[model samples]
Target chain A: MFEKLDPLLHSQLRLAVMSLLVGVKEAEFNYIKEKTGATAGNLSVQLNKLKDADYISITKEIVGSYPRTTCKVLPKGRKAFSEYVNALSSYIHPNGNE
Target chain B: MNDAQKQLEMIHEMMNKSQREFQSASFYYLFWGWLVFISALVHYLLLTQTNFTHPYAVWATMPIAGIISGIYAAKQQKSSKVKTYIDEAIGSLWLIVAFAFFGLIAMAPALGIDKVYPFLILLYGIGTATTGKITGFKLLYISGLLTFPLAVASAYMNFDNQLLVLALAIFISYIIPGHLLKKKELQMANSDA
Candidate 1:
């Protein structure tokens, strides 16, 4: 009687991104990179996967002379994250104990 | 532990990592507080003590302060990594305040400098209290709301004395709170480190 975790968010790096994003309205690409401790190239690839699933929205704009990219979690992504957490909890504490 | 347990722990770690402490926005309060404090005092001296015909010229510093504030804010925006809902709300509130401030200054000639002090005090209360409430900083909101009566009292006083009232209000609402906020930031940073 275990529900399945959202496979899209089950991976460590992707899950890390979602968890961090759920805590903020929006964060810069560089900020996420620094927080997640993932290489830029790998983070970009993972971010695209989440973006393709409508899990997050990315914005690119020129601030002063630099092109800054920002990412925000969408409602669908938040819901999936919540569900994933529930599934994990259920698996960890089947009888509702530690 | 199982895979599920490992994932759960990772989630907890990531969430904790992203949970941030509040940014110290004490800079705005301190900068504006000192600016208003000095300007009001200078205005009072020029009006009462000096035979200066253009005592009101002291307030021409507003545009310069505005330019400095704009540049500072732009730099803060550029350096900020995460944008929280609180920041967004405070940003919008200050934007409105800026517009209202310039509007009041433009109308000062028509309203008379005597009339402008009270309105400026009212604006300060509105901005401070709203910001305090939004940021969940009790000292800020309390001092901010306390300025309302000060504004009303300033309206009844003469122009020279009104400057004193304005300085007092700025002292309580902005300068004191600004320093306390900065102190809190330092303490938090120390604890975090």
Candidate 2:
């Protein structure tokens, strides 16, 4: 049996954001937007959803008079994402190959 | 798809998306590396061909511009799925700066301007290797290793002609490795899909 994947990150956009965040320490708003090709409105909504789950932490500040929002993957997010990958791998490989 | 299946599919999709982004980033950096080398070569050639001695032209400005562009790329790469760009850029910059420092110091000893070129070549090669290590890119390491003999051989060339060594190093190291990493990343992404 496999562990369940988190529902919050199951959505395409949210999952994309989290997936990108997983490999990084933190990402700025524009950085996420450019990579995912997600509109600001949509990304903002998806990020808020992740924040609600406590999977990611968002910090807002001003850089040269412009607001900068940076998102970081929390410990919970890392654990959940790892478990999710493991659970999914079982489906593809059927057995632990590695 | 059932809820479980749907979630699994979603996860898979995300993984694939991330892979694609990584692939693109690898190629992007590779292109920039080539551009930097080629531009420097042009500068060197112009200096040799014509009567121009803008001290900052080949020596100071080129590498500084390359480093600045690299930093920008890394900052923008913050959103990339695998963080490959930022890692590569950081590693490359670290090695490049170190090499430049040593190369500058070595230039003064009449160690011959010729000997210094090999150091520059090695710096770029090591930079590629470090980038590869950070990103788990096998090709980068291969490129780094391949450049070793070429860098050594270039030591025998005249100082004026040594910039060719820099060009060759970039082609073998950063350019090829960058492309290889991108290819691997794309394959991985497609596999996930």
Candidate 3:
């Protein structure tokens, strides 16, 4: 039997975002879009999904007359990501239990 | 391969990409390195050759350098979309160095100028070595490691020669590293373009 992966992080764009955030302090929305090659609407929607899951925090602030949306991985998100990786490894080496 | 394994591979790829982008912060290193190099060189020259009463007047360059660096940092921050943990850690480390420098300067009268260079060298070692470890840059690590002996050597020297040693230390630990960082940044930028 394989370990279960977190559905929230199993998607392509969301997983990409999480992977990026895991190593960074925080990142702006535009940066995520640039890195992931996701459309603004798609990235925004995916970010909302992760935010709703309590895996990430989204902050909106005005800087120099521009509204900036920055995203950071929460502790919960880090935990989930760790577990997800563990589960992934299990599947990758399921028969290596010898 | 199953879905989970595929996702894991994707995660690794994305993480690597982000890390690569974060390693291009050569401007800050170059700016401070050159500023300190020039300031220390001039300070040493003034002490040895000029009749200037306060050789310390040369340190006025620090605030001016700080102002230019501040403007550059703010502009970089405004333009940068990504902020990495490594970037934040290095930035915080330098900030602490700045405050510690001010503290040392304030206490210089009591500690005496002869004792100052050793401490400054030690601090440089710590700053550069840790930065090297964080960024996986080997040259920086070597530079940082060299400062330890240099600091110890400066401790036994007279004030004037101590100044010369300090300049030499800065050249190894900062100026060389700064230029290497700039070269790396340019290569990365060109590759990207």
Candidate 4:
């Protein structure tokens, strides 16, 4: 039997954001946009969704008179991402142990 | 492929891409490496070539250069759009090393200046090796490994000879690796452009 993937992370863009965040301490809004090739509006919406879910934390601060938005994956988010990956692996390789 | 398999691939791809895109400002390494190199050489010269009795005074360069480097690093970090886990880890590691240096300096009077170089070299070794492990850079790992024996050798040498060993260790462990890192950063920046 396959485990259910987290709906929050099932989307292409959301998963991509989580994947990027998983490797970094924190990333700026522009950095994530560049990496994901997603529109700023779309990325902001997805990021907000993750932030609301407590899967990530978003901080807005001024850097050299410019407002910068940085996102970091929370422990909850890391755990969820790992579980999601495990579920995906289980589905892909049913005979293999997670 | 099924959706699950596709998602798995996507995750892997995104992570790999993010890792690849990561770039550090190589200026800091270059700045400190040269500063230390010059300082050590000048210190050695003052101790041997000149009538200068205060060879230790040359170490004043470290604090001055450190202040400048700290300011530059802050500016760079402020401007940077992303900070990686590796960056944070390396930053923390160096912070610890810096404190250790300070602690060693305070204890130098009791431990004697001659005994300090070996411990300082060992700290350099630890810092460089851990940095290599974190970045998966082999040159830095090898440089770090080389410092261990140099540190041991320094223990058996006189102060003047130990200065030369420190100079050689810094050249191998910091300057060379620093230049390579700068080259890598430039290549990454150019490729991005």
Best by DockQ: 4
Per-candidate DockQ vs. reference? 0.66, 0.22, 0.72, 0.78
Off by over 4 Å in 3: A95-98
Give the Cα lDDT of each candidate: 0.89, 0.69, 0.86, 0.87
lDDT by residue for model 1 (B15-64), tens: 77666534568898999999999999999999999899998798788889
In model 4, residue pairs whose N, Cα or C atoms come closer than 3 Å (at least 3 residues apart or on different chains), thus clashing, are A25-B85
Give candidate 1's TM-score: 0.82
Query: What lDDT score goes with residue B2 in model 2?
Result: 57
lDDT of 3 at B154: 92
Return the clash pairs for model 1, or none: none
Put down candidate 3 lDDT per residue, B147-179, tens digits, no spaces.
999999999998888878778888888889988
> Is model 3 an incorrect, acceptable, medium or high docking prediction?
medium
Worst 10 residues of 1 chain A by lDDT: A89-98
The per-residue C-alpha lDDT of model 1 at residue B2 equals: 97
Candidate 4 on A1-98: residue-level lDDT in tens? 87888999989999999999998888999999998999999999999999999999999998768899999999999999999998889888888855
Instruction: Output the worst ten-in-a-row residue range by lDDT, candidate 3 chain A.
Output: A89-98
Tell me each candidate's TM-score: 0.82, 0.59, 0.91, 0.93
Interface RMSD over true interface Cα atoms for each candidate: 1.5, 4.5, 1.3, 1.2
RMSD of each: 3.5, 6.5, 2.1, 1.8
Find the candidate with the highest TM-score and give its number: 4
Query: What TM-score does each prediction get for chain A alone?
Result: 0.96, 0.91, 0.95, 0.97
User: What TM-score does model 3 score on chain A?
Assistant: 0.95
